[model samples]
Target: MGPVVSKFINELSKKPRIERFSKLISGLRNFNKTDQKEIIKELESVMKAMDKNELKGALTVGVFEEIKRMIEDRKLGSDNDYLLMKCIGYWKAMKNIVICNFGKSSLCKRFELMIFEEMNKKEGKNEKRLIGLYESYYLLSDDSIHENLAPIITSCLLKVASDKEESPETEKEVEMALLALSEGSRGILVKGAQHLQEITRIIFHHNDHRNLTQLAFQCAWRFMINNWNSNSNSQIVVVKYMNFLTVVKRELEELAKCVDWKREDEEKENSLAEPKATQIIVRWLDVLGYFFIMCNKWDDDFYELVRFIVELFRTARDNEQEISEMCAHALKMLAHNENSSVDAFEKCGVLDVISEELQQLKLENRLASDCLSIYLQIVRRLSNNSGDETDEEKRKELKRKMFEKLEEEGLEDVITSFHETLEYNQSYYDHSLSLNIFDYFVNV
Candidate 1:
């Protein structure tokens, strides 16, 4: 032990119960800055020693837990020692500690109780506290938050998010509320039927605010996916999110304004202020992807969705990697749904775009792998989804024509080289491509 810390611990151990721990806290809080640093360092040592079971009750009294329980139970309004501040350096640190040191143990329960009780307290309604609660749930899955507390947390979130109309601080509160509910294991939302409806309304009202709308877009998607019934009348279930779809379609139409649908444009780059424009567009495209995956109909702006994705890819030039990756990924998801989807792809001339883009991207190796993945799906679906059904002979005739087209575009060696590159580099970009596209097609 260091001489200074050993001396302090010996002095600390000699005091009686009533004054011992409280006096040490007083010193830790009020002593000269140098001495306080030394004491806190010693206390940290004690914490480690306690954790390691190396210090077995040589010193007495469990002060912090006792103080926490007493203060909360007695409604002692004092912010004693800024103790909670001294602890919880950020919810990230606490989350890592809980997961690493105490995996689902009594200590975790104690920490959860302290944070939740503070959040639910009526007298202290503030942004920082709400944010702390947000981080708590965000970092941990928060299995500690039981069913009864769900309504309370939901109400708290509603109250916080409702303040966006007033001022900036309140707006931040709304942002925090949106993040907490949409993200992580939001136990509050398990009981949030009315809550989700209200948030959806808020999303519509603030549809002009891109960041809020995007986050709220995600929250809305989560609600639909969670409540979606895959078996029982999927149409009615899909119809429930009609308002969400209408809002998204309007916003997407607004974004696609002045967007060039032709690739390699020299003049028409959508060079906008605030790259946030592209980001929000990506979010909207993601929302549309989810819509198509779950809804799976040729209705409800489905044709427009296809048009938008095709334009998204066409506008994705050499510099816009994020846009290209997301466009390709969203396209791939929708394309895999059914046979009618493949027909729509070809009908939209998207297959033609793919052939040309393959020849173009043949040299642009720095581009995203999703570009390759998208076309691979098209070639695979066109062949594999066709079988020995009524149109077998006719299907082969159509496949032959498509193959002739692909071969003319020089995709045969491209596909083989792509498969060989992924194999050689051991870097498979998207596993969903299934590495089996070569088995169904003949060479050039």
Candidate 2:
């Protein structure tokens, strides 16, 4: 016999099944670390030289029987890391070998099913063991294995989501693993959105990892956005998922505040580290901005939508142009609703910022015309709200101040458009004038 064969037989003869399995796994470490194609050829050669079915039969029986015997004899300690790692190595080796040869097929499915069946049986007795099985499955990267393993991963994630006793660390690890698996097999996950939402909620609530939460949001967002077109049942699910996102947004806001406060202190001690809180706030604002814009087309709570725009402006310090443009778009939305326009003016700092930008435009480009249009809409709305002489005086004062600002900035075209729109509104009370002005400025 060759060295490898003789060494394997000698170990198998001297050691118990578990110890022999550990040694076998130790011997295969270099093989697993090499190129999978080479590993596959070597494993195939070994399988051919040794009886494949006989080895599998012996290993399966030996492992299962030993586990049972340990349980009955009360000899098995809680720590099963060695045994679990051995199982992981064996399965991972088989998985890599199979993937390097044949693509995903019935043979791989049979292997996955057998592994899951074994895990499911043990899950009833020990959750940690089942988790170990899943972690092992998660570590394997064969796309074929992913395709075969997605449903099982989804089921396991769902169980973890529902189990209150599972630690947040374990849940976060599983969530990341499930995300990686889902990236390889999207369709299987689309069919499992209900379970996915449950997992989303668990992660959103219990886990504190930002990247993990972001992945959960992305996964759940895909499901919700796609299923929005399905039946009412699916639509309801989508809404619930959106509501969960809203909760997550709230949590993120709180965490962001804490980070901001902490970073302020850190900056005092170390001046080189740039604060990333602005980036995080901007990301969430962008998501909220899109969400509000989508919902505002059908909903009447325009003030609620404008509050997010106001928050964006309040938080934005350095990126004035970007925030100003976003605020301008949001104001355009509110301008369509007469009641919302006045509330937006009172609630948002758009007027103050637009005035500042317009002043700066004397030296810079007159791109402040975009904000100028929204300010004009607010003035028109305020003018319309006025009935008495004093209110009319205040309205004209506001309009005169805006026109003077535009004139100083050399935005003659904007000033002329505003005058023409006011005159047209005076003659015909045309709401369409606002629409036309909004279109002209938005395109500009």
Candidate 3:
């Protein structure tokens, strides 16, 4: 469409094999007509104009060699960081070219081996070169690349994370490595299992610094979440590699203690500052819900984990509302597992605790709206084993008995609280949700 693209396409069609790409190679030399950005855009557009298959075949040594020469040439890279950044940007832009014409193919593998040879520790650490190479690989990374690339990249990340003597400047390198792992294909995540434990240990160490914790969880969660599957082989691998879940569970259990750490002070003082350490507690609970949803059945320790959550709901600060909302959601997921029974939690006084929390919401109204679904889910889940009564009148009586049981369990105002929410919701704001909420109660 543009003159540069039009001229490049015309010149490309006029040649064959390596020669067809001559205009593109020379386009990098800038004949005083355009800058690096325009040249990069022209290269991108030229690739788009040709047949993808033909383009794949035409992908030859000349194009890569030219780009490589341009980058390696000290005048462009070594002398100017800004220009080197642009060169890297140009490389990233060509990812579509790599993916379109060469991705997952032996060609990609071949290119990677070349990069690895150049970037090897024996060759010494060249952050610029490594960054460029990894950035390109990160862009082209997918399922096909993972089987080969994951182990290599994950190894690099482990090394970075484990190096206690690593400089502060190297944090980016560590982050880049983890990011590459996080973005890998599911097979890559599976492949990443061999190094996961060491990686987890390293991440836990770094998470103590807090600066790296978010990416730490992301890197850890990526492996755990991606490898999670129902297949027999995957299950074995997931279970073996998924001790990170136990780590996370313990950390979450401890953080749940902070939920009520300052409840008395928080209730009375707007001046009370929330601890930054506890900020991610709700997010941790939310992530745990995914784990509960995916696992086929409870592990032997899962009952204790459930008990922990129940006690947490009884104590955690509801001022933020997220803690309780996510806890309730995770409980709902546990209920969805037919093998999971509410009997154990019943003995823990969990129902009574949840009821009192709902009543607490009623007086405060700080989290009343958020707790509605939570309260309703608690009541419905507890009523799962209502009875074997068959007759309609008998069922009505049974349902009434269930309601009365809820009152005895400390949710005396549960129905009344839900009604208030239903009224408030339907009057002005919610329609579908309001109708659903009304049905959840009325149908019972």
Identify the runs in model 3 with alpha carbons over 4 angstroms from their true place: 1-159, 162-222, 230-246, 253-260, 263-276, 318-321, 336-339, 344-349, 362-404, 409-413, 420-444
Where is model 2 more than 4 Å wrong at Cα? 1-164, 174-249, 259-280, 296-302, 319-444
Evaluate all candidate structures by whole-model CA lDDT and list the values in order: 0.50, 0.43, 0.51
Per-residue error for 371 in candidate 2, Å, reads 6.8
Cα lDDT tens digits, model 1, 1-444, are 556655765787655433443455444433444555555554543333221112222222344444345444542233322323233222222111223222143433554565577766888566565555544443333345555545665566656666556564555556555545543333333554676566556655565555454444554455444444445355444444444455555666666563444434333232312133454566566545555566544554556656666766777746555566566666666665653455556656666666666666643242335556556555565565455574555545556766787668677776666664543222545555455646535332
Ranking the candidates on lDDT from highest down gives 3, 1, 2
lDDT of 3 by residue, 1-444 (tens): 457656755666556533544565555554332344454454544443443344555555445555555544422323232232234323332222233333534535544774666666775677656545654565444445635555665566556556645666766556555545554433254553457566556655655665464534555565445555556555445544455446566777656555555566445333323443344565456556666656654454566676777767655654544466667767655545443443534544544555566665553342454345444544455445545444334435545644666546545445555664565654543232333533344235
Candidate 3 displacement at residue 13 in angstroms = 60
Candidate 3 structure, TM-score to reference = 0.47
* TM-scores of all candidate predictions against the true structure: 0.58, 0.38, 0.47
Better of 2 and 3 by TM-score: 3
Model 2 C-alpha lDDT versus the unseen true structure: 0.43
Among these predictions, the greatest TM-score belongs to 1
Worst 10 residues of 2 by lDDT: 94-103
lDDT of 2 by residue, 158-184 (tens): 555345345556555544444333332
